[model samples]
Target: MNPKISDFGLARTFGGNQIESNTNRVVGTYGYMAPEYAGNGIFSIKSDVYSFGVLVLEIVSGEKNRGFVHEEHSNNLIGHAWELQNEGRSMELVAKCLGESINVSQVLRSIHVGLLCVQRHPEDRPTMPSVIMMLGGEGPLPSPKEPGFYVGNSTQGFYDGSYGISSNSEPSITKLNGT
Candidate 1:
């Protein structure tokens, strides 16, 4: 029973020994929802991790990646974090409230870890164990691969029906083994 989490709004009631139940009502903060949970009604521990990751990035950077905008760059907070991290200047990502009390390296490390947690691919995202281990400095973390749906590719388009090429508009090509 974590005292901090015991009073969360999303918390629900359950039988003392029951495990794996369903819910008729789906309710939570929008930006905090996992894709599957929001799309469907599924909920799990990993959903909580995704929300926590969002919270962490927001806490450290004082910015919401979901709607972050910069006058100089088109990239979101995840992209900004990646760029700053790649350039070895991650301290720029930290919130001003912490001031000099925050450790630059640790803050950067947390940003990296948070980015990894919120990766678009659920399988690519680390399990809670990995996330906990990362925060606790338990073992060497794996290098995060590029985030999915990376911005600025014209060929790729929306998550909805936005970029499909009509077959009627193009001739099909048949390649022969010898020709």
Candidate 2:
């Protein structure tokens, strides 16, 4: 099902010309959260765009962003995609199941757009309208920079060992402070 913004319980609404907000508490699904929101509790339009990019990548690859592992490389899905894109092998990211039914050009474009959304800095990410335009072939897309949290391996810090949960397990609650 397509998810609505209100379906996300942690989402906050703003009024007037406000575009961003800070919170002492940070909470969300770990893999989908933007680095600024997850690391510093700074939420903005770009943060949601980051999540959208992850979703797009997941849909294209049939893989989860969190707990993704590669045998030949230690990179996560984003890092793997980046590596492949740089090496001129972005088509490798498409799920095998898609097979001949998939349009190669569209898949490559989608991958490019996903990487654009997950760029390290918020300003580097395209806004929703810009993203739509890019997807529609409106203009040349800028090359993507490194993605945030592009670590070589999964770290224990993402989990709460006290709960006897696996590192990939979603916690009941997560709190973060913004400065």
Candidate 3:
């Protein structure tokens, strides 16, 4: 039993022996949810790991994943962090206010671990125990692969009921009844 996790709000209810489960209805804060849980109602310990990674990134960057957007890029906070890491500028991800006050190595490791937790595949994520080790620098960390919800070069636009065509007036509606 992990004393560290016993005090928090658990997202799932199941027997102690159950390792994973499925549901038809998905529930939780979307921004922190794992893709498998969000898209297929699959829930497990790894889902919690994914959420933890998101929280770490949010804490370090002082940005919310759901609504975060870089002025020059269409990626969210996760994507932005991945980009920064890829560009050899992960330090840029730290909030300006934390400058020089935070331990640089610790923050970078946190970012790396966060990215690992949010890997596109559930199996790619480290177990919670593994996460703790990685964060504590117990051993050399693995290179994080591409993360979930990367959404590269996405464009923002509004879509009305008219679809792509611009129509100020409402279109005629047609209903069919098979009586």
Pairs in clash, predicted candidate 1: none
lDDT of 1 by residue, 33-130 (tens): 54444444455555556666667778899987666777776665665666676677878889888888877667777887887766555567776666
Q: Which pairs clash in model 3? A: none
Off by over 4 Å in 1: 1-27, 36-44, 148-179
Identify the superior model by lDDT, candidate 1 or candidate 2. 2
By descending TM-score, how would the candidates be arranged?
A: 3, 2, 1
Model 2: residues >4 Å from true position, as ranges? 1-12, 152-179
Clashing pairs in 2: 26-176
**Which stretches of candidate 3 lie above 4 Å from their native place?**
1-12, 153-179
- What's model 1's lDDT at 129? 64
CA shift of 76, model 1, Å = 3.1
Instruction: Report how far residue 172 has shifted in candidate 2, in Å.
Output: 11
Summarize candidate 2's per-residue lDDT along 1-179 as a digit string, tens digits.
Answer: 12223223233354334467676666777678877676666777778788888888999999988777788976668778888888999888888989899878888999999999988788999877778788889467799987866654334232231212232323334735446
Clashes of 1: 0
lDDT for residue 57 in candidate 1, whole number 0-100: 75
